[model samples]
Target: MKLAELEVNGVSWSPTKASLPVLHPTTFTVGAGKVLGVVGPNGAGKSTLLRLLYRFQKPQTGYVRVGGQDIWDMPARDAALCIAAVLQEQASAFGLTVREIVRLGRTPHRSHYATSGARDEQVVEHVLGFLNLHPLADRDFGTLSGGERQRVMVARALAQEPQVLVLDEPTNHLDVRHQLEVVSLVQNLGLTIVVSLHDLNLAARVCDDVLILKDGHPQGFGPPQTLLTDSLVSDTFHVDARREQLAPSGASHFSFSLPN
Candidate 1:
């Protein structure tokens, strides 16, 4: 259930000969029950790294491991069982109902042409309840608004019962409240999560660790307070990160100040 000493080395992905690499050589590790925040500019390969780790594409070199075992060496089904991904584009293309789409999360555990048993149903119910999706469970997937659809995707991923949850731009279409709710749910799950986020402040609030990427390479990696500073933000994001302290808890937050 924990990822210890995880590393990705010499990993590159190129679709065409002249096409630039999606992910250049990158290496980093995340511990268990901790959230890793990935931040970068538009083309920093944050999504590419998530794809490589989730086996959407094979790495040209190096490795991805879970618990000291090479992920590629593990059976694909087994890997799917342990790692659940909630990608930005995983919308229901088939017009499936919300509950039905979420139930598909159990596919990795199914045998040949098998149906979901009572346990799978229980998990699906649990996930919907956890995400507060019971009110919308019977809705058609395509009929939901962007934020609603996004929550459905999160529920699906949670229904898989994975130890490691990977989210790529999960808050892309969400409003402020939904964003906080979805992030809170993920944080409370106590799962090893690697979430690629464009909003650096949200990352600081939700994640325990951080990895900064620029042009498909690592710019920095560490705790949020250490990595989310003014200089690094200015360098990687080309903007100043101004700090402010919140009330009561007095937790620090940041704002992006534009260049003159």
Candidate 2:
């Protein structure tokens, strides 16, 4: 899939006309093939911002553009062809096998009366292998572990051949190894990625740039190394954060304590 730039220009949203906007006018850009990490405390509107990017929800005040074209102006199917999302909530597979579930990603590319063609099968097979799910391709999706299921969801998204990928809390319930694996996979995808993550260290490690949110307002936006300072973390997350560099890799890491 060709990489595309993602732009959010002063986008804002609210649940109803009378409700206060859950997301204030927010703006950011993810360059072609770059990974942008969204980080914030719960209810800070990270997911709200992501929903706007993937066209799951329309903004009240601004435009979400992909490759310089407004997504709201495109057909839903056309938008799906360019952008794919792996949401935080896993979908029920209804006893479907892994391959069957992954095959569903091809829906946006097919006509209503069209059957699964050779190219669709090829793409599904390739995505399964790319995510190393070949061993479980025949297994019922509901029978897999949390990490395995997460990988399957990712494979399904990959099968879409999307130019931009949006993942909402992709590593939510996984163990340490699986979390690292997911982070590594995302970093190597070579697609424009917008991922919302609660783990600040993972965001710092995998993201080219980070967008910090607090109470539905943008707190900061820039490279993580320069933007995720101790003071910022403390104020936004309400934690005492200490930054440390690992011994051999010299990567930035954080340790947090409850505020005194």
Q: Which candidate wins on TM-score?
A: 2
Query: Residues 99-170, candidate 2, lDDT per residue (tens digit)?
Result: 999999999999986989999999999999888899999999999988899899989999999999999999
Question: What is the lDDT of every predicted structure here?
Answer: 0.83, 0.94
**Candidates' RMSD to native:** 2.2, 1.0
Quote the positional error of residue 127 for candidate 2 in Å: 0.8
Model 2, which residues run further than 4 Å from truth?
none
Q: What is the TM-score of each candidate against the true structure?
A: 0.91, 0.98
Residue pairs with clashing backbones, model 2: none
Residue 45 alpha-carbon offset, candidate 2, angstroms: 0.3
The residue-level lDDT of candidate 2 at 189 comes to 88
Off by over 4 Å in 1: 1-10, 16-20
